[model samples]
Target: MVGRKPERKSAPPTDVRAHVLASATRLFAARGFDGTSLQAIADEVGVAKPSVLHHFPSKEALRASVLDNMLAHWSEALPRLLLAATAGEGRFDALVGELISFFAADTDRAKLLVREAMDRPDEVRLLLTAQVRPWQTAISEYIRKGQRHDEHFADVDAEAYVLHVINLVIAGLAVFDTFRVLLPDASVAESRARYVTEIIRIAKSSLFAGPALSAEPRDPSLEGAPNRRNGTTR
Candidate 1:
């Protein structure tokens, strides 16, 4: 009897690094990098300052990791985006829908990006030039192809158009919570639906030609395209 002891169960290992990054991202998005502190992040994660430092080493390193995480998400999605761009019909819907989802899935992402741009313009500029510019160029070339085929507007400045759409999405989502108040009659969910719908409509209407604007059905090939909203192929 006294020799018998109950076995103790071990708790699952915590992913402290991930928790720290998540807290840092949320805090940085809500309050600018200058306003957020490592101690605050530690508190949010319910860990000691040393635990945060054990993972990130410094506030600057944490900030860079947050940006890197966002960029990693985009990099993973780049292939799908490129495919949608060159896939011809329904390309606008596919491309724009994915873009919206990328940020709208977590508005924090948009806020973080906007804050980064304002807080460290030079750094953001370098990141854009080095990482985003190539994707922009590739997509621009696809737009040019569409123009050549008379599928898109000949006068559309492909580079500028892409850039503006990106800005519209990021900036729109960043402030959407505040902006939704204008639609007083609608619930938050309804307002968001309308907001996203209008963005897609405006983007499509401005970029496409005859058939796309008219009541013509979407291409059969794209009928089976993945539902970007839910991440499922139809």
Candidate 2:
């Protein structure tokens, strides 16, 4: 006797949502938030954009969902590193190292972050608000703790220090990768490795009344992380 036909299983709803967000991440990284159309995103995923809308109501929602998921992943992955830095385990230097590992692992998502900071629409601003705000707060408190423990400089300004370190990392990544066409000879891996190391060292350095360290040269990956801060504020 012939066997009965097997039934096909439907794709899980969770899987469908995951695919949509992954597609959105790639498109948003290459095409700016505004540049990326829902239709284009649908085409990338081989589903109707409306199918994407079923999971995420709008493009803004999609971007936000993708970003939130990325943030959640970092939170889950970095518990040990977080404890080391916040609990005064002398791994303050390693907190920024976490950022480097994250960047190297998913360059596009990291690029999307730089892009969000550069041209953030009102909705995308939440991404920075979520990441930068907590980082500034945590770094400030941690540095203050280090100062009390004599681990950091006595007179180091935590706010200024955090901002400077962020600028160094964000701007470092931007300039290296942004202008690659013009500086085609630069190596992103070699240069970014050095820049990340230097930035962490800078964060860990003492704040003597002496002169500051000279600004580091732009690395290949950082070419993309541009700053238009030439006598003009954003």
Candidate 3:
């Protein structure tokens, strides 16, 4: 008994489920859903295939859970984030900052979304309409309010602008690591800061009527919100 090595304990069920979801997300992002198998996910999570199925009944269910996990975080957090700031430029900064932070906190999220969009446009469209369209409409209405108040640029298409900014943030972050190679002189942190800063700047400048709002920095607190994954607070 003295010479025996201790047995490795298995992860708790909740932790195993979370790990399986997380691993499935990364795998589905790297390889399309059709390409990734339940066995691969199990291997990634260091568990047996039955362990993965214990939580998710099938690969389709796992993929759905993974997508839902990402969207669920946004669904819960977006309203709070929007409410935290006053209207106009405050809301603008809050929205942009949170958007950037959400994806930057885990680029795999961006990759997963992008991959899904590319691989399954119709499915993603339907999912977005159901889950994301309300928020998009709310933000667009806010933009319209700013326009009516003469705070935002006249003639800006509110829906189009919101859609474009969403795409910019997701697409930009999806390829951020690879794109950083173009900025050879800067450290990864510096490059990332510059990258996000420019995005905020561009978003502000294009939307705001005057230069004052465009020059203000985004809410520092929004930038610092803890990274969330698999519907759990971190």
Q: Which structure among the candidates has the greatest TM-score?
A: 1
Summarize candidate 3's per-residue lDDT along 76-169 as a digit string, tens digits: 7677666755554355667677888889888888998999899889999998898779878987897899899997899899888988898889
Candidates' TM-scores? 0.81, 0.66, 0.78
Candidate 1 lowest-lDDT run of ten: 4-13
Assess candidate 2 and give its lDDT. 0.64
Name the lDDT of candidate 1.
0.80
Q: Residue by residue across 87-135, what tens digits does model 1's lDDT show?
A: 7667778888888878988998999999988889999999899987997
Candidate 3 residues lying further than 4 Å off, grouped into runs, are: 1-14, 85-89, 211-234
Clashing pairs for predicted structure model 3, backbone only: none
| Model 2 TM-score, all chains together | 0.66
After superposing candidate 1 on the true structure, give the runs of residues whose Cα lies further than 4 Å from its correct spot. 1-13, 86-88, 211-234
Q: Order of all candidates by TM-score, from best down to worst?
A: 1, 3, 2
* Candidate 3 displacement at residue 98 in angstroms: 1.2
Rank all candidate structures by their lDDT, best first, as comma-separated numbers: 1, 3, 2
Compose the digit string of candidate 2's lDDT tens values, residues 1-234: 554333222444347678778878888877778899988776666666578899998777898887788778777767855765564333544566666566656767666777877776665566557667887887788678867877567788888887777666655665556644443335766455555655665665543222333354322332233111121111
Model 3 has how many clashing residue pairs?
0
